[model samples]
Target: MRVSFLLFAGLLLAAVVSGCGGGSAASSEAASSGNTASGFTSSAAIAVTDPVTVGTLKGMSDALVVGDHIVVRSRSDAFVTLNGQPVYPGTRLSVLDKQGKLVSTTDYGFTLAAGYTGDWVMMLSPDGFIMVQSTSGTRLQHFDAQARLVGGVTDLYPTVAATSTTEYAAAENGGAVDGNGFWLATTFSLLPVTDKTQYVLKLCKFDFSGRQLTPPFMISTSALHPRVAAAGGAVLAGWLEGGGGMLAMWSKGAGAPTIRSINTGGSQPYPLVLTTDGKMGVLWNGKATMTSTGGVMGVMIDNYGTPLLATGRTDLTQETLSAHWDGNVRATVIDAHAYKGGIAIAGSAVGALKAGEPITDVLVLADYTLGTDPLSSSAQTILRFTLPGRAALGPTPVLRQMLFDDHAVLLIGDDNRLQAVYTTRNR
Candidate 1:
């Protein structure tokens, strides 16, 4: 395992925009009431923490809060040929305590081949196990509550052997459930049938034991950018189709998945979030034709694949700021969390840029109640933070709401350094 570390001289502080108001820290009344009195109110103080060092990387590939410690998975910067196979970089897992102190670090010797198409998995199971599946899908490593690797299982099916130039975001092709196992929605090319090849999309479920729990469910012959989410014993698989997107909802004993097309403008749906109340929230970019500026649109759907809102859609960017994407400067949704009776959306935006100014990025956190029209005009609080440091945005920032329920953190990497901030529902 090759490890590299960079030491910083000064501390960077984030600039917070205070106009938007947040609700009380995990207050049930604030959560139950679907309203934000101020154009921006203070529910969470949005505390800024000093950057947590994790070494050189594009950005945090994935991050999840387990207990009070944060387990972060990052791909290293070094690239080399191992065993005659050109590879990208080795995978490293780091655990950090509440005070931004590093607890432990583990380096998986395996490196993903260049142009690997499979999406990796790092999820926390309900029983307090941190499951890390390699991009190859050949090995499943388990970590105890203390972030220690106890043992691992191997040899189910390897998905990373095939190389494709097509790029993918983290968890773009797969997702996991808390208590249940994870699901993968992918396409496989079948052998030549009548001298012609055919591609088929499939959704498969596998438990932590590295065992396939159910037979693969057929989705469609062709689909792009597949995403999955499961909750309340129901699973949702979605993919880009035509100019919009298609969704399929299925349960354990259900006959088949119910399919529907969603109108999300031109951008693909992202970050599928299943709430505790058997509701699913789908978010997408509402971009106009030939314009970099776009609004974030969201919709709430019940487990039965039925719309829950009046119009079945909420314009999140309208209540906040529009996400603009230029040649390099870009902003889009990253992650979200469903709270007791509300939900919070996290995004990244480009800060003010000049010829000689250090490039800064902004973190957008928008909170909304989960009642009728959660993101209604009067029900959302959007907060923006100008992050510290001069770094070019490549790897998207990683945002994870802590398990404590009252706090959330964002990991930003630039110039081979990692920085973080914590947001809370307090003044």
Candidate 2:
């Protein structure tokens, strides 16, 4: 995916103090009047509508939450227009949530320059300065968010990475050539906080009060691109290892990271998810054995990098592999039967005990609880969807992405269209 860079400049203004800040009458009056002179408004919503189907095909590049709104970007050369005006192509489309309706839309016109997995959208402008058009792509601002304008935009590198709920890491280059003919690597500027240079990676934590909790924590890697995932007060930082197309994971307070020892052997491993509950899962292509004879296998790892499961048959020709992980830490693997080519093999945390359960099947949602073994929990299937006509399952066949939100499962099928299946069981 191509990440675009656009200069965001508007005005300078202080953040509006909310009633929650203190019991001052000024703050109370501001709250009573509902005057959001600051770009950041207390109440505003966003949403998507009549999304353009690019080339008759739908593609979801990336998405993130800005306040109460959900912003989504498409990888295809597609632009979403509200009313009829075309939103800026490559710029992220905002979806605001208001009461029960989508209140407004805003286009920041900034292009993401890196992969979307670790990157997200952030609201840089204050509520009033950030004017959003209904569907006309018009620019308006009720308030501004940028208070201090650093050096001319040219000298400022607007690279940003989210570090926590209210904190972000931003860096800039001084535009000076170093001995290596590269731009003089200037110290990363910890924005919205202290101006002191204490660390190289420019690790700094800032709360909504604009206070810096800690000095920047330096890293050995000069080009360390820290990817932060915050959950339950734990922060996991993931970054790409130099030259080795592998990922390195480290926790903020959990000391050094335990690198993955297993070699991709050549295939690239994709980091599918890092759940808020601290469960990390990765998917990669490999060989596995199906019978006692011998064969290849598909590889999967747990949060601790433990190889808990593998799939594949001895015959080099049989390409059978599929896997899915539910909340209970149970993984379901579907593979082709080695001897019986027509018979599909289905294996789950519980199916492993059933010996030879049916193969060639679909997922069935059932209530499940964590078992002692973690990987072998039982789940009752409340519903199932069958897929017609079966072929030799490949390692990536059933490895489609599935996201669970609000008791609803959103599956991105091979066709790329999102199918949201919700569970209606009464609690």
Best-matching candidate per lDDT: 1
| Best of the candidates, TM-score | 1
* Candidate 2, 270-324: lDDT as tens digits: 3322334444333333433232111122322344444343143222112212222
lDDT of predicted model 1: 0.53
Taking all chains together, each candidate's TM-score versus the true structure is 0.71, 0.37
Model 1 residue 343 lDDT score: 68
In model 1, the Cα lDDT at residue 206 comes to 76
Residue 118 lDDT (model 1): 37
- Summing lDDT over every window of 10 consecutive residues in candidate 1, give the lowest-scoring window: 1-10
Please identify model 2 stretches exceeding 4 Å from their true place.
1-59, 64-70, 75-89, 96-104, 107-228, 238-255, 260-262, 266-321, 324-406, 409-427
